[model samples]
Target: MSSDLGRAMPIERPDPLALLEQQEAQRLPWLLPLRHSRMAENPFAFFRGAAVVMASDLARQPHSGLMVQLCGDAHLLNFGFYGSPERQLLFDINDFDETHPGPFEWDLQRLAASMVLAARSLGLSEKQQSRVARRTVCAYGKAMAEFAAMSLMLMWSAQLPMKDLIDQRPSANLRSYLAKVTAAAQSHDSRQAVRKLCEPDASGTLRFRHQPPLIWRLDQLDEIWLGGLDWHTWMQESYQTYLADMSPNMQHLLSEFVCTDTAIKVVGVGSVGTHCPILLFRGKHPDDMLVLQGKGAELSVLAQYVDLPVPEHQGQRVVQGQRLLQRASDIFLGWYTNPKGQHLYVRQFHDWKASVDVGKIDADGLRDYGILCGWTLAHAHARSGDRRAIAAHIDEPEVFARGVLEQALELAELAEQDHALLLRGIASGRISST
Candidate 1:
């Protein structure tokens, strides 16, 4: 019988540099060089930054026609540990900048390809890399099957605790590494973030430390362009608009805080040039401060390929996608369009959020981590997609797993070639790195 699973479709590959140029047209010019530098680091690094490139390719492929609210840029690094509203540490997809409704296997393909690239980066043999990819596919298949049989309430309540993940470490070295990472994540609260990013000024007011090209206070900009108003006044107006979207209780809680400072914070490879501003607020006491990130949101790359409704506001689309996919999300998550018509989403910054050190993980550890990532992706998809259909499509787990593994290997090879092309572009000055 013909199968929908892993069907190869014709692809008219776009010129990589031309696509890069198209994306660059939408980003801040100064930051493109930094993005290029980061992407040039290695194949895995390029994979992290080339979500649009992969999305372009995936758009041409035959899909299973199974749709889910996709974590559009799903990769190994995007899976991380963050605190739930109740202060429980849970592991899930932490980045949703490009999230939207798309073919479910698009996410699986992105994640699987990431594993292969990451494995190659660590100098793993092809056999070992294949093992990791296979394990990931199998884990996803099994998890989806489990979700297919689970009660709705149980599925909604389920979470993968950080402690359980650490305990599942395959070796003593990995266990010790995870323990340290977990401890660091536990201590990475808002206060810790404030301490790291902010310092007391001469007047005793907390101000963000100037980190040239990466982080800077708004006042440090060459011009004050907040509609001819002062920084503080503009911030207050923005806060009120953001506050309007919160619940009554949350609004009351937030009302107790006063805006102190705001700064431009450049973050992530794929999100480098977007407008990301960190807002600082002081609560009842000086020590009680909150740092919230306002990140610019734009149309998802997948939007071009799928026949979906254009979101009235991209920020709202991201916020809704995050709520649907994550078991628990940041309590303060919201969105609003700025006066300039730019869509931006707001969330508490680094409130006990941390990511595993992928560099420290050995081959066995990578395999284990892949399993967790696969299972987490499965859960997110099961929540939003028809789990029964997904489970049925993944029939004969081993065959599906092998097919995915082979596809991942092929994609990895292609990614390496693309990485080389990017490097050549940089060297030949076709792509600017300065």
Candidate 2:
């Protein structure tokens, strides 16, 4: 631990089931929405809007052992938005707060449960839900098999680009939508992003303005970064390593716009309590801009099973994982040890992105999207783990896909039941909340 951070932030470990019991009453409110979600059925959505019990339930769960690289909290809604470095607007896994290496099953389970949840939302018949889920798992299984067989070099440069994504399905509406999303994505880099997200102060200096409740600029943190001992070292020492790791062109470009910027809390469901900060900077030209995000890195939800070292710095796990998982990672992708010795992983915030809404998709679209996510996730996982063993284990995608969907149905039910318990716990005040 850094001398600056006197005591490490003790890792939080909560009893997921008991926490649910305590949060149950509070969750009774969103039971209905959860039920109608695409994952499972029979939830009571009486007072449908609530995040309290949901947050506590996820916060309390025991870690899963299955992360050979995993997207922490792989629920459906967590995926969405942003542009890619190529200036293409594409969709893929966006959140990585709980990312860690353990058992790969954890990521699969979370993803399946999310699908079931979305299906429930559509009020699909049990059979319909099953079909949608089956399609998704099958796609995932198939994709994993394909990924496991690739050559090392191919795996490294591999990308499920938007063209390949839209081409898999050759219909007219999708074709049109693909062109639209593609065009929009190409024009959505950080410069345009800054224009859309920033505003001028009365003094004419550019500032990010919050539109009432949704968006807010966080320049206040400048004091914390400037005056704090940890921040001083991080800005001076860590910044070099961060810049060194960027791609050549990105490095040169970032050289111009890499000035200090403010950070802000953005959005996510499972990651509500986590630190997700965005850095805003202006380059040589007023229009030259970049946005980097510093998201909190914690022990993987898979920590319970893995033989990890005593948590020296939580951010190390993430820094290595992102390096391992993505082919062309952000130039500033690195970890920082804070004054309080907190570990944080940094990346380009609002880097191009997109995700298909599994919940809103028709049964066919749901199946296709699931296959894509499975394929993409498998490629990521295979790169991080023992590819030989994983490939051997999942040689057959079609059969394994079916089994995953079946298992997901069961897991989805459990998630719903647990969610119910959480609502009760919260309503009874067994779990404290503000």
Candidate 3:
């Protein structure tokens, strides 16, 4: 670790509300209220949406100088269980919207800070929050050491299955909770999405159900929202481009399915107000359905701060970063430039995607969850960066833990201050919130 590993960054902090407003300007105008409201829900929620704020703060700090493909917004909620292409329920960092090559410590710091904020949101004691935060960092260091000792092949092939993770838990209650989460996740396939989000239209063709402000059919939206783009032509050209970017085998499999419908589907705290669309496809049989989501991607938040090559297409950056970091990626993952010239990544939607609600878990469960996330993050970093160098720098897990926890605690406090500022902005009508 550097002499100033956990030392606070010496830089002037920007006004949180101003930074937020500037960022919001680039997003959809009407959905700004929803984004503000979601972020104002709590400090944890605020922290989740304020990745840009943290990126600014971290930019001024001294780092280990060891670069890795970072999950730029590595909050706890971003680490979850999702179905692999092989149909296994694997636990890993699931979001890569902000992923880019940067110092390995940036990801660790973000995760550590999230653990503290998440624990605080759950009403856990300060002692408990400290323990959870430290445990997360310590587990990350320990995992990196273990990865360092493993052969490259073994380390690259490692994966954490939900079943295996559940079996390893010592507490029956925790195991039971994990088991329930696993079962629920397994049920979140295309069939489940169709039941919940789709319905038969007057023509007896399956189409997405209209849920205004969240999900809206193409015809239901105004011309301004569509920005004069021809929905049919856009979908046709976009799907062709997406298919061209996919593997030949996956493209062959997709050739069997024809896109039937598409709807604007707003999702996620940070991602709200972005141009995200959900597509419904039908195969040879009416019952055979597939749902895919296209999320607009921009340059990573870390790109401005780090001296790395900027990707020409933001969506390609996300797909490539995800492929390098995840143990097993979704086969349908691909990128395309939208009609508006915005880059968007496409992937299977809600295919056994599951996340633990940190706000609902007890202190013990939070600690366990943090450890799992920590180890998973280490595995991701090990795959994309130098495990041996990171392990050597981490040398002593306890020391590294203390340093990261110190920085995380400070960051958690900074987030609280920012959250309070957001509340004040809403109260004064300076920031809009629904």
Candidate 4:
């Protein structure tokens, strides 16, 4: 925004080998599997293996604007609704640890690519897929304009609360699934989790009960991944930043409720292989306690595209971005640098955490939900800075929707192309398998 970044920013992308050398943040094993996926390529195993190459190409794209913030491996799956500091239910782009101020198109490109891939997976025809893409882009266009008209307070206040997002929808299929998820989520309270997961059975010692796709004890992951004193130290730093960001009352409440000194297993898709440890802080009663998750933060992928001078410490980036982007942020959100020199971003793991399941929704449902996510993401982008100009640039959803459909088609091809290249590299032994 401060500069015509399209021309000003460097387009020199980082080399794959060089990017992989950075610390925990640089290694993304999840991308490897996708590159090797045969659906995209077979000579070397296509989708299972191409993350580095895709990022490399993405980093080289021309800059769009600088109102951008970090977008961690943003894909269709990553966009979801969560409760904001305020109780009002509205949706927005949720992940930000790897956020950066680079080409706005970078986010768009990634989002479009993911949407096409998702639609393809759903067995939609090419034309049908493009329609889905068009609708999402159109939604984004309107949402951006809508956001440009709002005040910071209003933008911050809106949240697509789990209940509101799921409950408001008219579909019975979604309602049933959401109801089940909600029940499971609410029932698995800290007290309940502690009573079940943390409390050992015959052994009689408190330990994490393995909850598939959700909760796992620390010992489950490989040693190299979760290993080190660095994790513990980072948790402390993350908590300190959390303290600085919180109101006195909430800070004191968190301090009393959280144990603040232990590590637990945590999991996420893009973050599958990283070291994410949960820190428990028990307060007045276990029921009144909170769960602070210190997930690992990595270098912004945008770094490949723009010079985007940022905090050298990834933990600081996460904590800083959360404070800047979200008005009603988690009271315990924080970051710290550990003795082992690792960085961790700390926050309450679940403050009514919920997300829309677009994959399961019917074509019509996905269309509407896609629009909602686009709108919410635009609103978020607007809140981060002056969005009136961006809004003016694309007022109606029509042109942008067409542009998005075109871009999605192009990006999908690009993904397939890069995935093929990755297979070649892997076969030649230039890349490593997970």
Best by lDDT: 3
> After best superposition, candidate 3 residue 227: deviation in angstroms?
3.8
Q: Which of the two candidates, 2 or 4, achieves a greater TM-score against the reference?
A: 4
Q: Report, for every candidate in turn, its global Cα lDDT versus the true structure.
A: 0.84, 0.55, 0.88, 0.58
Better of 1 and 3 by TM-score: 3
- Give the per-residue lDDT of model 2 (tens digit) for 1-434: 23231223235634554433333332223222322231112342311112223333332334333337766556655454455455444465666655665556656656666666677766767887777666666666666666667788887667767677677664444445555655665565667667877777778866666652234344434455334544435454545555654569766767677555454454443333345556677777766777776665655544443444434566666666655765555555667754444567777665655445444456555545555666666777878776667656656766666766766776667567655655565467653333
TM-score of each: 0.95, 0.73, 0.96, 0.76
- Candidates 3 and 4 compared by TM-score, better number: 3
* lDDT (10s digit) by residue, model 4, range 1-434: 23334223346644434333342234335443432333233311222123444556665444345456646455665665444555433345556766766555556656666667667766778887787778777777777777777786776565566576677766566666666655555443356445544655475635556563345444554445444535444445545665775668876666565453454453553454455677666666535655667777766555554655678878778777756655456556667654445666776676556565555766655655566567666655666656777777676769867865776687677666655655566677765554
Which 10 consecutive residues of model 1 have the lowest summed lDDT? 1-10
The RMSD (Cα, Å) of candidate 2 is 7.9
Position 254, candidate 3: lDDT: 92
By TM-score, the better pick of 1 and 4 is 1
Which of the numbered candidates is closest to the native, going by highest TM-score?
3
Ranking by TM-score: 3, 1, 4, 2
Note the clash tally of each candidate.
Answer: 0, 54, 0, 39
- Could you tell me the lDDT of residue 248 within candidate 3? 88
> Candidate 3 residues 1-434, lDDT tens each?
24332333457888777877777777887788899999999999999999989988887777888989999999999988899887989888999999998899899999999999998888889999999999999999999999999999999998766667998876566677888898899999888898899999999988999997889787777656556766777788778888888888888899999998999898999998888899999999867889999999987878777767757899999999999999998888999987668899998898799999775567888898888999999999999999999999999999999999999998999999999999999899988878
| Model 1 CA deviation exceeding 4 Å by range | 1-10, 224-230
Error of 4 at 398 (Å): 1.0
**Which scores greater on lDDT, model 2 or model 3?**
3
lDDT of 1 by residue, 255-319 (tens): 89888899878898888888788988899876778999999898887776777664678888999
